[model samples]
Target chain A: MRAQSEAHAPSRMVSETDELCQKIRRRKPSIYSELLRENILEVLKCSFPRFGTALAPGKLDEIASHFLSRHGAKRPQFHHIATEIVEFAHRGHELSKPLICLLEYEWILLSTEIDSARIQAPQLSGNTNWDTSKISLNPTAEIVATPFDITLVDIPVELDGTEQNYVYAVYRTVKHTVVTRSLSYVDYCLIDLIRREGEVAFNALVSAPPVQLTTDAIRQWVIEQSQNGLVICGTEC
Target chain B: MKENALGIGLRSELLEALCIQPAREDIDFLEIAPENWMGIGGRKRDQLDILADKYPLIAHGLSLSIADTVPLNVGFIRDVCSFLNDYGISIYSDHLSMCRDSSGYLYDLLPVPRRKENIEYLTGRICQVQDIVGRQLVLENISYYHRYEDQMPEAEFLAAIAEQSGCGLLLDINNVYVNSRNHLEDAVAMVRCLPSNAIVYYHVAGHLELEDGSLLDTHGTKVGEEVVRLGHEVWGWHGPRPLLLERDNQVPSLDELIREVGDVQKSIAAGDRYACSI
Candidate 1:
């Protein structure tokens, strides 16, 4: 029994202390819980202004509390927490679609702007067969398909899901500026296909159902995106 | 960095003003959280590069969790080392409290039990962190809400950790003041017991006095006169360590922060003269 107690000591301490932490957080009038809740709400407000106004008083606190209790052990960096809040909010379907879309757009911009991953430079592979070359989106880049063009709206109040057909490719440039560009439907379809599949051969991209554009047009677009650092070709084949 | 050097935390909100005027006469050094800057690029990275190039940067980390029960995060320590090396920062400090548990990071500086076993547990962990960091890990005393039963004095607990692990202390005056007010302890007595040589620097900030009369260490306001006075007393005891003003939220313009820096500098000068007289 002594040996068993000794063996369980470390685990026992962790459980006891962690449980205490949970209790302290849940206890009424807990300043610790208030601090955590306030911090999460502040970050979200800065990132998602419209959504901040959309939520009622203490609503964000409840949501943030739920998020913290569920994922308490996960390290809470500002960007990571923001990402989790976006996902959590989406899963709950509490906010309107437009608000969610705006949150997603802002999150992408914020995350990409600060992303430190060094993506490989888009280089033209010297392969002979161009149709078989691999294509990929820049790791720092993101693509969004919104029903309406919410990007132009300064304040998003209307929740009406208008289908204005907006597809955007938000990416940071080599100069370190984050810029968004509108993509043609064909280009969006092609990029979406590439996103769904990790990296695709040029031949596969051309044969994909979205490639209603001429083969030459698709080839031109791929080369243009590669040169712009949006995608990389595995080989020039 | 000279003794009694006045510094300010390099918050992102004040980045633009700082960049335009990087060489403020009153400012001595800049403190940054390595966790925030690590693996980040673009405008923020560029801004960091510009500021780091101009100032002597010190790393005051928020996520090291040196007092936790889990195994040390060697990868994060290595990453911090890499960043420090990249930018030529020497002093790396974190709170001497647990911010994480086995389940995950709690994202708050939770109080560690002030018992002998915890001291022993934390001493070993601090040593491991120091070994990995390749320098002495300076720990700050955090202000916490809850108190444990059969616990040693907070100052004694911290001193024990430092003595056992051979680590340094970042004596945050505002935290001392806040904890003393909240816990009904003698703030000056606690500061007096800390080993003088172990204190590497000082952190002074403003805190909020809640309706309950308990103080919260919120770095969102101007540095209070009482905290500044305590800082002066600390300088008198330790003979003027670097005093860093931390303004993490509601950060004002650079001019305003620099003015605060100048205020601390004036107090330090006064303390210096007072020391010379004695």
Candidate 2:
């Protein structure tokens, strides 16, 4: 009896592994082939696994394709896919889902730093300290981890030199993280100011200085950040 | 359906565009997303405030989730009412689909079962929305696939919703075409069943076809011939409500979209007037 039970344990373990592998396989072509869909699913799975399961493969693919085609990803580059996914996810899939799904997805993806380098890089500035008391990440920012370095995965051979690879990855990482982090910080600051001083101007959030930055830089940063998720222009903020 | 007059979707992108080209005597009613300006403050609110004074504003919303089984988001409904009260937006509208679930939001407009229960449930929600907004809310037909087995025929379901809710219809010609091609339904028959008196507006847009022969409502391309024909047919019955072009992705130059809008206007005038005389 003891021998039979022990033998059954290995089979059960193998079956579990098989199920997980099948799940990943079924998901990869539809969800992970594009970086944005992958990231959105990753964040969703982490935050609300049950709800995430409800995301139809067809819907995710449609959204992924819509995003890919929108960003001018003519040939489906990983970076383009990732960028589009992040933007769509950040926008909270407005045309398709509830506002909260987006909020929850953004919260999960931005809060977790999959790449240790993203969390530790000193050259990239802004508040690195994950203040539990405050929301440190932007609602649109996402941290993704995959088997392939998404930045290096889809480039042409000539464009895939070591120096280029390193530079591209670094730039992509900084660009996504910085925009997300800065936007989050700005939103947080805006919320805080709204509480402290009622009826705060949108411009005030853009103009306010962080402990280590200038107001002009902050404004420019906010505008740059706005290009992705929020649109900012001429409004007195 | 008289299409030549330019009607701009009250998108945030167009706020600056509107300021640069404020409501001219020729420009038609400005279509505003009710959700965008409802209870929201700051620049968008201020811009809407200014535009409302000049242009005849129509409220469009994405978050109504009229087809959801869950109870209507009363707070959102109240906020929309308050916005309409302030702005005097009579022609309020939303998509004919659900976008929310128990888990908060899926963020994408989703397909709903076409069964009697769904139609009845949605009609109740629409009634509540109409009561709160203090006007008959126009429900736009959505483009979708993956039909449920229990669904009644599409035309019957829509007719039921309109009849029960007493809400007006915003018949999207492009959506009808997309659905017809995808699900192999008769687009004209679908239009025939819709309560003619309740249809107060028409929507026209472009679509992209997938490899599997499925159509997507990308709204990025120009209006196809079939949709244009259907739009003319709709105008024949309903005269013309404020027909608006919605272009979200693959956005062409304003000139191109404007030209398309012009074509719709021409078609509406030519077909409808000729039909009435006949």
Candidate 3:
């Protein structure tokens, strides 16, 4: 009898819960606006995870307030919403450049993540032949420049950022993982050139860079890059 | 990937470990959020290609916002179908919630009302998505924080949608467990009431316990003992199916995850054995 009653306990809970839902339903009205508010809040929380803890006082509030106030009567995608929020944070809040730098870095990761997923593998143009000089940009890659060295946000505030910034590459790997790494100006030039020039020769790509390098050095760099999937060789392309 | 036990989501943090380590005997298959992998190139895409070569891929989309009251994104659906076909992935699922409507992208799954009007709307949308994808999508129950007064019970709503849309269910057992405690619903009864045939897979994940003792489905912590127990019950009730362990946050070391998979495998076996005896 005890065992049987214990088994029946959950069923009893079910009915009680159903009744509770019914009661709540009767008391409350629709959840359209409530859910809209909830979604806005949720988006703010997810996209800007550190607004409250990491950023300066009032920065988060200003962004949220501006977004909610303007977000009237219509819904917008979070990315567009995030951009406006960042802009609001910039204009409305008296934030330090470093702070803006930090926020931009954080937001870029999101935009990059969402943007890359939407890219379709470029129809290879049916080029099965590999040419040493011919190369193209990785459709799944992003190139960004930021000053804050958000790469090093933990260091003291004064040491965090500078007017001088560097370009960084965010690329997807075979594992479908997005990897972010800083790039030297020379390295950026080489890749950006490859992006601009569809398929080119090793000698031609090397010649375009202003910096003088031995043929051996250029060959070595391409060889190194090809290994990393940054620079493709004739057959692989 | 293990061929017959519980699986895990392929998160970015675990990519290197998955590539370096020997095939985890515990992972039956890997669940990829197509939103995370599709169209990405370079090492991540290269590595995913390798992983795909090694194991079967199942897509669980974070976007698609299926319940939104807006025109269907026919182009996006076509792209999704192309991605699935290119990867040779058969099973694609998304949360039975909305992320975007005409207003904008919510970026998170939000619950739809359990009203007849909303149900009819979702039925049409689900069918539209299935038609575009060229396969029926497996819709998962979401762990939502609040609910409005609805026309029917949650299970009935889910069943109705599954029946009307002709879609399958990707039952997230932890959602049932979390929602049960949060909303005062009965998780066990919720599982029992769901149409068993519609259930194509299961998801169990860890959740956070808030200061006030509320359970938040953060997927950042360890899977609680109760959820594992509930997994057994779900398996017994629904019979053998693909059960995925989603750990997006606070992911453990690969070795630890392998052990977790091993543990769930035992529960799956127990559920199967009990079903056989019955």
Best by lDDT: 1
Which candidate achieves the best DockQ against the true structure? 1
A best-first ranking of the candidates according to their TM-score comes to 1, 3, 2
Task: Judging by TM-score against the true structure, name the best candidate.
Answer: 1
Tens digits of lDDT, candidate 2, A1-237: 000111111333233323432332334453212333444444344444433444555664555444433332221111122333445555545433333333334334433322222321222225322121121222223433222223232322222223311111111132333222322444445434434553334345444554345646654544453343222222221
Global lDDT scores for all candidate models: 0.77, 0.55, 0.67
Worst 10 residues of 1 chain A by lDDT: A1-10
TM-score of each: 0.82, 0.56, 0.67
Model 3 chain A, poorest ten-residue lDDT window?
A1-10
Enumerate the candidates' DockQ scores in order: 0.32, 0.03, 0.10
Better of 1 and 2 by DockQ: 1
TM-score of 1: 0.82
lDDT of 3 at B96: 86
Tens-digit per-residue lDDT, A1-237, candidate 3: 000111111233234333433332233442333334455556567776754456657656555544443432222322455676676567666666656666676677666554544333322234433244455555556777866455763523444434577688776543444557788877887888877776567667668856577777776667666555554555443
Q: Single out the weakest 10-residue window by summed lDDT for candidate 2 chain B.
A: B269-278
Evaluate candidate 1 and give its CAPRI docking class based on DockQ.
Answer: acceptable
The DockQ assigned to candidate 1 is 0.32
A1-237: candidate 1 lDDT, tens digit per residue: 000111122444566567767775564467777777777767778877766666668776677777666554454344566777777777654666777777888888888889885666666754536855888887787888777775575545555555575888888876676778888877788888988898988888878886577778878888888877777777643
- Candidate 1: give its CA RMSD in angstroms: 5.7
- Ten-residue region with minimum lDDT total, candidate 1 chain B: B269-278
Chain B TM (all candidates) = 0.94, 0.89, 0.93
